[model samples]
Target: MESGDLLLYKRAMFRLAHISDVHLGPLPAVTYRELASKRVVGYVNWQRHRRHFLHDGVIDAIVGDLKGACPDHLAVTGDLVNLALDGEIELARQWLETLGDPRDVSVVPGNHDAYVPGAFDKICRAWGPWMAGDGQADPVGRYTFPYMRVRGRVALIGISTARATAPFMANGFFGNGQARRLAALLDDAAGKGLCRVVMIHHPPVKGAVAQHKRLVGIGRFQQVVARHGAELVLHGHSHLPSLYWIGTAQKPVPVVGVAAAGQGMGGRNPPAQYNLFGIEGEAGQWRVHLERFGLVGAAVLPARIAELELAPHSAQVSLSPH
Candidate 1:
């Protein structure tokens, strides 16, 4: 390897990167034909209204950052592709394969991943090889999306919040079913003194869910979190990074989202970004340093960094909350 490559590898050893909402491909290629609803019209309108791209800019930008960060493990909250198009899923895999070891990268599904019929099944079957590691055991073992990992000082509790609700809904769901098992999974993780990271596609509370009751069921979900007292909660689907103070919980566990990749291909900038988490300090005093990275150009550059402080109940908290 070149001297520069060796230096990069050396630097990458200390960070854990968080990037979500890549939306990897364009409308036609990224989506199987839209369901018979307003969503179809929305997609058509988006293409006409936004920037067009041959390769989704966000994916390239994220891959570029991955090479630079060389993280221990990359955690993606969800929405890897715009739609569940076979090509889109394939596109996501191709990008992941190119960016970093598919092994080092972990993912949760967002609403978009389940937009089409049977999208999750096919993507999981095709991509399962890269998602597993030695001694990895499924928590629910029921679905590909809801799983767990004991990464570093934090124990990651990933859950499936993706669901196909109705035409009017662009929001997310965790289903009452997963809610039943979430507490158990979290209890076990916390009992071991692991700093819990609850990953989901939908915000347990925030955004459109605030205005529309039918948008999603964030209340019940937060109930599970309150009971378990998760250290951190990483989320996407809003296309904007956010931090909401969970009032009932013990402390403010950060709920973060990343801008969608390939932003302007549709006039939407997606804020095109990602973040890094640096875990350090002693046992009772563990800390998280949230660092921000933005995509500068189409060539996969992530520059412009910032940091946030994480309390014990903190996860990968991003600076400059939108």
Candidate 2:
């Protein structure tokens, strides 16, 4: 191949980093009024348990390692705050700035982001730049789901599953409207020969989370993927490393999940981790290599724990122990 052809081929390759559930901590001081509603339950949870495991240092270490890897784009799958406090939301915004430019990072909201009746609006207002669609001016007041951002050969479709639930509940809703819009987006991205990477907070697969924390309308999500055929699906909220195959057996789409970005090693949940995806090739012949990096044992530094490759148009996954 000519030098230019080689350069073009290299350009076709994209590196995407995925992280979620930061639950950014040291929960800000709350007033009686602030903790009057669902925030009270979340605050108690954080004080009693969550604050111990979700560490800011772990989040920083993972982000530092991720930056060193130099991904083309980063996808944050939500729960950046503990109680959706005003201070927490602002803190998350500042953290995002350090992560990367809004143009280079895409984000979707998790259940914690909308912990109360009005928290979702505040989250959108604070993180609108990272969540906005391509060519869209800041969607500060009016945020919409299934936003599409095309970078190189990849089209990132961000879906918001964030919604306020009652006390002790952590469910997400994927309504029919979003499903229809997502199907359309997938079809359009496919037509344009772009790799469609759908990012959601709650895993769309069945039995991924507890019944109370599960994604409502998961079947509808499956139907959309079955009909429109996405290239890949990425999610968080399970706070564990997982892999599931959706779509037809002949043309399976990989649905991947990562551990919480702030969970310390040896916690009840898996330790802090993130996923690096190397995407190359073209439509129908797309190649994907996934590497999971995180803390292991008592080590402060992150290390690659798993590596896998997804065969194009098939459900075959070759995983190599790290």
Candidate 3:
């Protein structure tokens, strides 16, 4: 490449690392009082199957590999804890610290984070810094969804699909309120010529998860995306690596998912993994290259399992209603 082209490439490139559904564990002993509520089900589930799959060592290795890649920012799409136990929340906080400064890491809570009615509040308080919007103060008790954080040329918009659900349910909600706010944020980000990356815990794509674990307002969520358009969407809940397209054929948006970060080898789900997105180019013509790294088969260290260039944004157009 010529000198001018090389310079332009360097100027436009932004590397982002994505990981989710950590379900961080070795459950801190729970008391009979704590297990009195919905925690009982989750605790039981953890003991039976999740404990065998989700491993802290796997998370450590993934994080270590991700840091070595040195992406410009890290997007952790949630399920940071298995039971949303107080101790689990604190442990997640410490792990976040190991990842990077709050400014460098962005997080969104998952169904497990808000495992119970009051668990969401605890998550907001403890993981507030990583979840806070640009120029926003540390959330005291509550933080609104559809938060925006700009890093160089990208706008990381986080929306929470996390909510307390009845026992035996792992659903999420994306109400109309957040939809309106998200549309506005997308509009503003587009106006600024920033690449919009929407982050959510539950996959907005239809049939992405079982009926009980689906996103409640999936239609409204897609309506907003189809109307305003987004460069990319990242989500977690399925605990498997997946890719789906939303929006019109002319301006399709890539909805990407990753395997649970703490999932060990030989589990039902794929081994722990993360995605590295290399985004470059300007508003009308953008290019995104995805590099997936993880433990495959019986390998101990994470390796680059897949790499591909995503659909490029050849035109700056939106399907916004006239």
Candidate 3 residues lying further than 4 Å off, grouped into runs, are 1-12, 138-143, 312-322
Residues 1-322 of candidate 2 have per-residue lDDT tens digits of 9999987765667999999999998888899999899888888788888888988999999999999988999999989988888999999999999998999999999999899889899989889999989887656432478899999999999999889999999999998889888988898999999989999999998888999999999999998998899888999999988888888777788999899999986568888899999998898888888899999888999999998886544343423223
Q: Whole-model lDDT, candidate 3?
A: 0.88
lDDT (CA) per prediction: 0.63, 0.88, 0.88
Model 1, range 1-322, lDDT digits (tens) per residue?
A: 9999977655533467777777665555433335454457446645765336424655665567666766777778777766566677887777777655665777777777766557767666655544443355652223544566776656776777666555546666666777777877778777777676777777776553445323366787877777766766777666665566563534555666566545543344445767777665433345666677765545356676566776535433335423
Model 1 global lDDT (CA atoms, 0 to 1): 0.63
Off by over 4 Å in 1: 1-14, 27-39, 50-55, 130-145, 208-215, 247-250, 265-270, 282-284, 296-300, 312-322
Would you list the rank order by TM-score, best first? Answer: 2, 3, 1
In angstroms, the error of model 1 at 196 is 1.7
Return the lDDT, model 2, position 311.
59
At residue 46, candidate 3 shows an lDDT of 87
Candidate 2, superposed: residue stretches over 4 Å from native: 1-12, 137-143, 312-322
* lDDT measured at residue 142 in model 1 versus the true structure, 0 to 100: 32
